[model samples]
Target: MLLERILRFFIVLIMAIVGGTLFELAVPTANAYFTAPLWHEEIAVLGLSPAGLLCILCGTALGGMIGYPLAPFVTGWLRRLSLWVEAQLGKMPTRDVIAGAMGLFIGLIIARLLGDAFFTIPIVGDYIPIVFSIVLGYLGVHIMVRKQQELAEVFDFIPRFFRDMPRVREARVAPQAPAAVRDGQTDRQYKLLDTSVIIDGRIADICETGFLEGTLLIPVFVLEELQHIADSADSLKRVRGRRGLDILQKIRKESRMKVEITEADFEEIAEVDSKLLQLAQEVGGKIITNDFNLNKVAQLRGVSVLNINALSNAVKPVAIPGDLMTVQIVRPGKEHGQGLAYLDDGTMIVVDGGYRCMNEVVSVEVTSALQTAAGRMIFAKLTR
Candidate 1:
């Protein structure tokens, strides 16, 4: 990261010099070119020439000073912007270390081969070679990234191939423990799941979709909560509880990756939310939740969260207003004359005047969808 900042500083410095020169030239000036005329009789300051190394050093220092404060904000925004791209492209360790090295070499070869012919054209001809340099640099970076991923995969395969190798093979095996109290579990590597996500049950699908990459963890407390909810008096809650258990079973049986249910707990913490956040801190794990309040609370407490609801919404097949669908009104909602239903993903469908359609699948046009931290909800009216 320090290296990243230093590189950015130099980049900004070069850009500043070029940009300042262009701005200086764009308007009519006595001298079309930059650099103060050496013929002038201006005296030196403190025995240092104005355009000397001292001046250059001072100029570089000034540029750095200007960039320091702005860099953090810019870099933060860049990080967020890069997230979408990075998630899609994934990180290339080799590319990160040596972006576009090979492409640059090839570009250099091509430029030398092309000689001055590429630059001899009229008007914008001189810029063609420069543009090609940029393109080649980008290609190199992409190639490096691909190489890094391939390298990582190859390394992984080597281990997998020897995983079953006999006698004195493989490193020490840490006995598997429940996720909550698993020995040697680092804070950042292992995220603990709360009861809400499990009972909500969308995470099972999320795991199956490859959206979730890390270990999908469940604390023993969470399992207990599921069992408790499954035993609830309310039929709806009970059904949801049972469904969550079923989902867990399916994840373990069918998912390609791990679904760890740990026995660790926050013995001192009373609330489940507090315990979750504490566990996340202890293990350096990001929480996965569909609950908006929990997501906000986790962030406030400095714990990372992979919000299942947000992920679901971000990846949802964009549904526009006026799109019609058939839904069954499940129950009466909070407001008078309001009714509620649900989509397959458990997204709430609040149909105004749907009270009459209770327990029945009726056709309705989507009037609107409100996405709150708690969950996503759709508002609709009867169409048939």
Candidate 2:
């Protein structure tokens, strides 16, 4: 309310000044043309004619009355505009904002240079620069923002001293090796985490063990998907999603590697998995996931994938034929006279001729072990 009043006061003051200036200028002209006594009649108190003073007062009053009603509308419009701009700016990343500002500055400079050349042109001369400024500014912002990544890449080729030069093409080296490699440094690749890996909650343990290296990147889209799942109506999905968020927090707090949440997104790609693949390809990073299908797809696309399930299987203790092991026959197996047991690590142990030993812990000798896509299985028989 106070802000509105302040805006109203400024509006009224400006309008009154305009109205009074118009009236004052007209008074002398009126006296010069009419020779009226009222127009020339000076007031002893103020040293101004009654007609001029009265006109100025009426102009001020008219201006105030007009401004009084318009203040609310003007203030509300300005408030809304400011809010809209703030929202837009909030959504844009810092890099994009900087690029857009630079683009706008360059566009305005170009417009100013071109505008002077056409200033002498007839009727449309005044409007030509304004049109150029608008069109060029929009084009500049669009081009700069859309090609910001490419622009960054191009700038990388230029030497530090020559970076400030206007002629960038002359100073740039030929595109051969990446900037990092050319400078004799190996850039650490990002390890992007997907929703499935986070939900599985084993990746946190892996990070804690110091096995995974490089920065751990979590894209905003993946986070949004987690949020959606967390808010889901299904109790199981909500729990899983919440667990994923918790795991991410734990990883951030306890993991040795750096964790980053990126705002990068692909609007055209609808699937999160596809986006992850595309992101990995673009950033030259690898995807760390427990999703089998995603792992296969990423492999097909030539994008590197670090499968958590694969790693778990690889690290499992190996069993060989003739190896003696103890097991508890929890239940009968599908085959006749076969009993099923499980290792502590969840590897299935099939014991032949041990059906009678159900619910009993017995000694068994391993005959063979079969490795399947799912996991490892040990086949053995009961020992006397």
Candidate 3:
């Protein structure tokens, strides 16, 4: 194929030369231009005999012969210059045809205006045209090379170009997330479960509702923490640890949401909550849990957090203070006069003056509702 292309190129070159020569012979202006010998009258060293004209024509043909070997080198150089500029400048073509044309024009003007004066000079006069051509062409090539770096000036142009183009209006659309990322726009969130909530077993309900859309990454450190609790001599700790493992399994098996058990433990930070924050940033994912301290830490670190307790509180029936409700007084509060009850969603109902109703259901009138990151706490009074 390459040989055929070379043959075709030579065929075209020969045809052009022959056609141009014939055209010049047929046209009066062209015939005068070609018949007028270049550098023939200027050279007086060769005698003005018929032999001198023959000698001048022979010299010109010899120069052409010398340049024949250089044709491939020149062709390859031009091709590389064009291809390299295309690679560098991308969409905006970097070819400086204006500069090159200017260069050739400058060369011709200098050669014509100073041709006689330069010829009057000694030995260097003979080389003046060649030297001028080289200098002008080099200047043009230098300008073109420098223009290649003009992209540095337009570094800001990149983002603006993308913005101005109509085709990329949805540039911000999140790349198709994995199929498991179907947490319902819940901020690609993860909800960390505290030992208590995992034991409470309501996290599985939240996952089942598909309210959470991000990869459920259970930090390996958290599992170790759970393991530490489970190994404790205390029965409650062991039960909670086993419950967390069970919840983890349910999340894995029943849900399309990705459940990743990442072994990211920060031993240097003694608190597991600190480790969770670090891992959240590493994964670029939100933290999910019921621990209030963990929630705060994640927030301060700029990591998103989903609190199961917060979700539970949000979904709870809004009971404004001054509303009366019936609840069983489950336990005594911190103060001697205080008794505590719980709503079905686990919101604490602190009942004042209801110690007598301990272990029994009674009517309590709501007072002030205290809301915190932990959850909503309802303060009430025994009116029964």
Q: Of the candidates shown, which would achieve the greatest TM-score relative to the real structure? A: 2
Task: Write one digit per residue (lDDT tens) for candidate 1, span 1-384.
Answer: 986687577667765565445444444333223345554324332333434434455555665566666666777787788888767545533335554555567666666556467777888787877777677666765675456545555777877566534422222242224323343546425656777887777777667776666677777777887898899999998999998999888677546557666666667778888877876776778888777788889888999988866776776555579999888899998988788988887788888889977899898889898877666778888886
Give all TM-scores, in the order shown. 0.40, 0.52, 0.43
lDDT of 2 by residue, 1-384 (tens): 888788888988888888888787778523333333553543423555567788888888887788888778888899999999999999986667888998888898999899989989999899999999999999889888877767866886577446435433422652222333234444657889999999999999899888888888788889999999999999999999999999998786557777867666788999999998887776678999989899999999999999888898999999989999999999999999999999988999999988999999999999999998899999999998
What's the CA RMSD for each of the models? 18.2, 18.0, 27.2
Instruction: Give candidate 3 regions above 4 Å deviation.
Output: 1-200, 232-235, 263-272, 330-340, 350-360, 372-374, 381-384
- Across 1-384, the per-residue lDDT of candidate 3 in tens digits comes to 585457445644554455445444444331122233556434333434334445444554554554456556655776789889767656432244444455557656766666656777788888886776677657655664455335433775788586536534332353222212322333545544445556567778777777777667676667777788878899987888887888777666555576655445566888777776675665567666677777677777898777767777788888787898989988899888899898877889989887878899998888898888667888999885
Deviation from truth (RMSD, Å), model 2: 18.0
Which candidate do you rate higher for lDDT, 2 or 3? Answer: 2
Model 3 lDDT at residue 130: 71
Clashes of each: 15, 0, 7
Best by lDDT: 2
Badly placed stretches (over 4 Å) of model 2 are 1-186
lDDT, model 3, position 52:
42
